[model samples]
Target: MCSGIEHGSCRVSDDGRLVWAHVVLGPEEDWQECRVVLDARDGRELARLPLDGAASGSHHMSHPDGLHMGLCVGMGQDGILLHWARRDGEELTGRDLDESSDRILMDVHPGHPGFLTVEHHGADLTLHALDGTVLAEGVPEPSDEEDPPRWDHSCGFVDADTVIASTVESDEDPDRPLHWMLDARTLRVRDAVVYPTGRVRGHVRPLGDGTWLTYDDGSGTLDRWTVATASA
Candidate 1:
């Protein structure tokens, strides 16, 4: 259904069943806005939700429960909007979440009640409940040195209770990026993650099975990582 028309990014739900994207509803001269949800398994058109006066966003996400969706609108502006919608009796009802900062929803928790978000400029991170309630917020502590690491937008939950995040200053070398482990609920620094030799780079992408994934630029291969347990 997204043929020969203006369409935004398409996001798939955590279950891999639902896919959605915002599209222009009419001709260029008098186009409106709407979101089209599709069934991923069979490529069938599922629902079309009208978006009156709603601006499209760069980042979109389908809720884990498969009943709702979220959009991060107006990025790079002085203020950003977090819009969410859910099907209500054949109609999609939505609202912009009331947030005090301009942040972007980077990742949603797997098998949990909260989602992860980072500041628009990647300065801080916050965890929020499914209903937009703030659960925890913080950034890693700066080290006692001339140049401390800055948190980037590459962050997500490593599991149900732990989050994996990275820090690489804009002017710094990407090969020397640092990563951290944080308590998902409290946003507290749990530890600084250190990888084995030659596998020390790449942003973190949680696989939701206690292991995470990373890509190596030099080798051009994806790597899976998990905490090594000590012998008894």
Candidate 2:
């Protein structure tokens, strides 16, 4: 196993050939850090990318090409920064996609040249081009309750054209987190995604294709889902 890896910050490339994570150096109190890329199968070291004095959060998304990535860095009460760098550890850059402190790097579009970000505890989402252009911003419509549902931390791309997002599970509707199907470019609500009884409750993992994976916290069971009908 690779040493000194920040487990929560690890992510695999879309092609499944490489794995990368934030590497903590020296003692735990030192907090000095770098990013290490490794071959997924054999755990061979590929490269070490520098943090350059920036603090990274637990989340990051790698480019589909496996050569570049966006890291959640500069985390603070003001906001988080999207730090960009290549596998070779060169040409580092950072972008403040949104000013919200809760903002995080979501999934990168598998086929398209954009990525997704959520802020304000999932009240809002933004689609950004690879060059940091704001392609679109989407906010969930408030429910009748005084406080809106806030379950979108698991949001991600379902396909190039579709996005999967969720609302916070309501106390009145326990075990039933409503998932929405959205238009990728416009962020328009298309429909609700309904699953069978075998469905799970954890984060949704989109596999680039039309399928996704979910897990049940209570049972520790995992399930893969696909549409069953034209409307689904």
Candidate 3:
């Protein structure tokens, strides 16, 4: 069910039949290997894939047509990796991200021709097409002088063109919050908001219609925000 590895990623199949988890093994002294575990209906291990080298990040994404699944992998300093499989656990393929960048992967958008958003040094955000083409890139402005923010984690897409990204001060101040509404196509800041409290460490996803949900580790709270129908 759970590998209990810190800083790993997990995802359930779109059909709700299988659960896939990629856990990092070995200590920092050794080159960590990513262990991909597939669970059956009863939460039993069906198959295991030991992927050599470090896994920068991993998550589940619905393939085109929503009929299959994709296991996205981020090999730090190497490149992006993708493992695709059918719902029945048959027919699988693995591929690299196509783009080359030292920037940290923020999240992958699961839609037609899936794309990825990565945060480069200096809080610059870069958007890449599924084929590894550079779509757009931009540097985000810090929230305030006292609380200069850094783009740390993000949710892929809130809609066809918008992504909700969580920014935080480098000094690790919980009372200062920096959130941004970025254009997925342009990688530009469309709007921004400050939470006034709490620290966010993950992507913000849409709850249903217009509301988004994100985690605040400082106060152990899940903060929800309603998307403004119109930009200010």
TM-score of each: 0.78, 0.72, 0.60
Residue-level lDDT tens digits of model 2 in 138-226: 76646676677765677888788888877765324655446667788988777767676733456677776887777777788877777
**Which candidate has the highest lDDT of all?**
1
lDDT of 1 by residue, 1-232 (tens): 3323323667887677777777667766676666777779987777777654444345697667777788776533336667787766555677666755777877775477888888776767888877788888977667555766677768887778888888865225544436778887898887777666532666778776777887767678777788762000
Using TM-score, give the best candidate's number.
1
Which is the winner by TM-score between candidate 2 and candidate 3? Answer: 2
Model 3 Cα lDDT, one tens digit per residue, 1-232:
1232235576776667667666755554553444344664788665555564456556676554555445656666665555554433643334444444455444554542445555544367676655456778766665556645566655456656666665646335545445677776787887765443433455576532446777656667776766653231
Q: Supply candidate 2's per-residue lDDT for 78.
A: 42
RMSD of 3: 6.2
- Candidate 3: 10-residue stretch with minimal lDDT: 1-10
**Pairs with steric clashes in candidate 1:** none
The alpha-carbon deviation from the true structure for residue 197 of candidate 2, after best TM-score superposition, in angstroms, is 4.0
Candidates ranked, most accurate by TM-score first: 1, 2, 3
